[model samples]
Target: MSIKLDQVVKVFGTQRVLDDVSLTIAEGEFFVVLGPSGCGKSTLLRLISGLEPLDGGRILINGREVAASGLHLAPEQRGVGVVFQSYALWPHMTVAGNVAFPLETAGRSRSEVTRRTEECLATVELTRFADRKPADLSGGQRQRVALARCLAQGASTILMDEPLANLDPHLRGAMEEELSAFHKASAATTLFITHDQREAMALADRIAILWDGRLLQADAPEVIYRRPRNRHVAGFIGQGSIVTVRVTAAEAGTAHVRLGKAGQDVACVADTQPGTAALLLRPEDIEACGDEGAQLCGRVERSVYRGGFHEADVAVEGLDAPLMVRLAGRPAAGERIGLRLRSGWLLPA
Candidate 1:
């Protein structure tokens, strides 16, 4: 099912939790809402799911108005199944019982509940543990049970609010795979919310980032990473350094920019307006090259080992702040090195 929000606004006391938010989730698409903590990521989910009242704007599910002005549909009527951050499983019930509970509550016959429960359990690969209590299951298994319940509900639209937050790192990765597979198999319009950038990148068909109750951006993962709209989006989506650059020239499909007072020039693959602008460079975008071969030269100020790579902070000659560069080999603290941004996006100043 397709879902749309038009100029949605939510406020609490004097705080505006969401402001003039509008978006559309296409049928059978996996969309993710991503942001840092307290950025109103969860609030947007609640608004869409009919769990919260909106101060203004409209919500449409399958082109039917669900929330607008004084009209608000009940959560159950929205035909949206929500898997909360807590999973919200019944503590005293077995996995099968929990999965079947929603169906039974909806007036489905006992036979239908049993059949749907079994089908959902199989979908999540939790059939063998159908009769087992949630407490007896591992964190991942418990998460699967929650997912299974959503499946049992037969809702074509699913809203997931950090359902894997309680799991450890390893389990989170495994669940991410399972959730993605489920999304594909079911072909549901899924809107997942999370604060984790990696989780958004890993699971989303497209990601929408929220900040201070404002929607900063919404785009395909690669586009958001490589061509962020502004400094805020560029800085938040990845580990990147924002450097000021003077746009010296612009063409039909690219721009030539100069960095620092020395006029170190580089070509950005964007049709940017010519003036002062910002350049976003991820750690991997900067290469450690020979001193004479690279566009910018710097001294290695710090190098810290991090698994397969070293996060080196370099003191560049013309820049005031240390430019972070990721390298496989660590350079000495005082070693002079050459640096060049292999690629970056230029944002209007």
Candidate 2:
């Protein structure tokens, strides 16, 4: 199912939780809405699910208007299933019973419900645990049960609200794989909501960054990370340093910019013109080099081991903030190092 939101608005008290948010999610696409806490991510989901009414604009599902002036479809009427962070499984029911609940409620025959429940359980590889109660399953297993129940609903679209937030680091990694497999097996259009950028990057066909009741940027994960539309989107999507640079020359999609008293060329949008502009230098863009061919030099102010590599803050002479770089080995504080500008993005003026 495809979802289209045109100038959707939702308010609470004096606050406009969602302000004129608009986007189109194609059918069978894994679309993710990412934002920080208290950023109306949940409210946006509720409005789409018909749990909350829109104050303005319209929402359509597969070309049919589900929400607009004076019209609101109930959750069940939307043909979308939801998997919440809590899993929301019935405590007293076994795995099979939970998966069978929706089918039974909709008046399917007993034999049909039983057969469908078994199919869903096998899809999630939980047929062995079909007789186990919710309390007897692990966190990941419980989450799978919720997914199986959603599958039983035969929903064309699925809405997930931070469904992996409650899992431990190790379990979260495992569930991510499972979720990807589940989506393929179900072939459902998924609208997943989460604050974790890492998770968003991993699972999304496209990602929408929602901040302060508005949609900032919506694009593929690589585009959002590499060429953010604005400073806010650049800062929010990944770790990087935004430094002021002088674009000495620019043509095509490359810009020759001066950074901290050194000149180097980097990638930029084609519209970029020669002048002063903000440059986004990711950790991978700055590399340690020998003094013979260094583009910039800095002092390592701090270094910390980040598992396989060390992340260091390099304080250049004229830049306001230190540039972060990944090092193969930890460097001593105040040590001088030569760096090469491998690549960077010039923010739109």
Candidate 3:
């Protein structure tokens, strides 16, 4: 089932949390809501699930108005399954029982519930742990039990709220793969919320960013990474640096924005009107070069070892802030170097 929000608004006391937000999630699409704390990510999920009433605006699921005109459907009546951030599994019940509870609650036949439970457990590769209680299973296994319940319910629309926030790094990676596989196999329209940028990029077919109580941008992962719409978003989304400049030349959808007269310039993927703008340059966009052949030269202020690369902060002449460069091997402090900037994103300044 597809989900649509039109001019959605929510208020808490006097502050508006979700301000005129509207978005569409196509059926079977994996859409992720990306945001920081207090950005209303959780509130948006609740509003869609009918757990919280909206102060204004309308919501439609599968072409039916679910929340509007003083009418709202209960959470269960919305035909959507929610996987909470916490694994809401029963401690006394076994995995199979937890997975089958929803089916039983919906008054399905015994044979159908048993068959669906087995299938759902197998999909998460937890068939062997079906008899184990929540306390006896690992964190990942408990998460799978919660997911299996969602699957057994046969809800076409699913909402996940930071479901992997409690797992370790290794387990989180494993769960990400499982979630992706499940999405493809089930073809359920999913709306996932998270503050982790890496997770959003890994799981989303499209990502919608929320900040300061508004929907900032919604696009493909790579598009949002390569061409952010503003300085705030470019600075927030990735490990990058933002440099203020004036766009001097533009061609073929690329803008050559320069810092100042006799200062360095970098080409960015942008098509805005030429004026003051901010350029976003990721670590991969920069390369080390000889001082004479470079557009930006600087003295190494510091170098931090980051396993695969050294994050070097360079203090360049004429630039107000130090430029951050991720380079192979560590460079000693006080060493002079030049940087070759391959590309960046230009956001209107």
Candidate 4:
């Protein structure tokens, strides 16, 4: 089923939790709602599942109005199942029992329930643990049980709210891959929410970034990362060193930017506005220069080894902000060196 939010808004007391949000999630697509804490990402999910009422606007599924001015659908009627961060499984119920609960609630026959329960367990690769209670299972096992329960419910649309937050790094990565594969196999329309950029980039077919209860941008992961619409989106999507510079002059395909105290014009992509501009240059894009190189120069302030690469802190003149450049080889402190900025993005300072 396709999910669509049309000017959706949610309010509590006087606080607006979701602000004029509108999105369209295609059927069978894996969509991710990404944002920081208190950004209303969960609230948006609840609105879709009909667990919360919208203050205004409408919600449609497959072109039919599901939420509007005063009307709302119940959670079960929406054909949506949600897996929460806490795993929310019952300790008293066996794995098969928990998986069967949803079907039982819908009044399915005993034989049919048993068949579906087994199918769900097989989907999660937990068929052997079906008789075990939640208390006897590890965290990852319990999480799989939760996923199996949702599958047993026969929900065609899924809403996962920070589902992998409880797992360790290694397990989290494994679960992400599992979830991606499951989504492909089930062909369910999924809306997965998370604060982790890696998770968002990895699991999402398209990502919608939210901040302060507002929808900032929605696009494919690479597009959002490579060409952020504003300064905030650019800074939020990935790790980078930001610098303030002046757009001294701009021509056809490049801009001559002046880094204060650093001296001279550095050629960069002509995407900056006049006057003060903010340049976002990823550390990996910066290179150390030898005797014959670009005019950009810096004094290596410090360097730290980060397992794979060395992170160098360089101080360039004219610019008050420090630049963080990533180098393969470590350059010692106080070392005067020439630097070449390979690629960067520009925004209004």
Model 1 spans with C-alpha error above 4 angstroms: 261-271
Q: Is candidate 1 or candidate 3 better by TM-score?
A: 1
TM-score of each: 0.96, 0.98, 0.95, 0.92
For every model shown, the clashing-pair count is 0, 0, 0, 6
Instruction: Summarize candidate 1's per-residue lDDT along 1-349 as a digit string, tens digits.
Output: 9999899999999999999999998999999999989999999999989899999999999999999999999998998999997888999999999999989998999889999899989988998998899999998898888888888887889999998888999889899999998888788899999999999999999999899999888999998998888877888887867877778887765677776544544546545777877777788778988867788888888889989999988887656567889888877998888787776667645
Which one wins by lDDT: 2 or 3? 2
Which one is best on TM-score?
A: 2
lDDT (CA) for every model shown?
0.86, 0.93, 0.87, 0.84
What's the true lDDT of residue 12 in model 1? 100
Give the alpha carbon lDDT tens digit for every residue of 131-190 in model 3: 989999888788878888888888889899999999998899888998999898788899
Residue ranges of candidate 3 with Cα displaced over 4 Å: 260-271
In model 3, pairs of residues that clash are none
> Candidate 4 on 245-288: residue-level lDDT in tens?
77777666466677754434444455555677777777766787
Candidate 3, overall lDDT? Answer: 0.87
Residue pairs clashing, model 4? 260-318, 260-319, 261-317, 261-318, 262-317, 262-318
Superposed Cα deviation of residue 14, candidate 3 (Å): 0.6
Lowest summed-lDDT stretch of 10 residues in model 4?
260-269
Task: Show model 2 residue runs off by greater than 4 Å.
Answer: none
Question: Could you tell me the lDDT of residue 268 within candidate 2?
Answer: 94
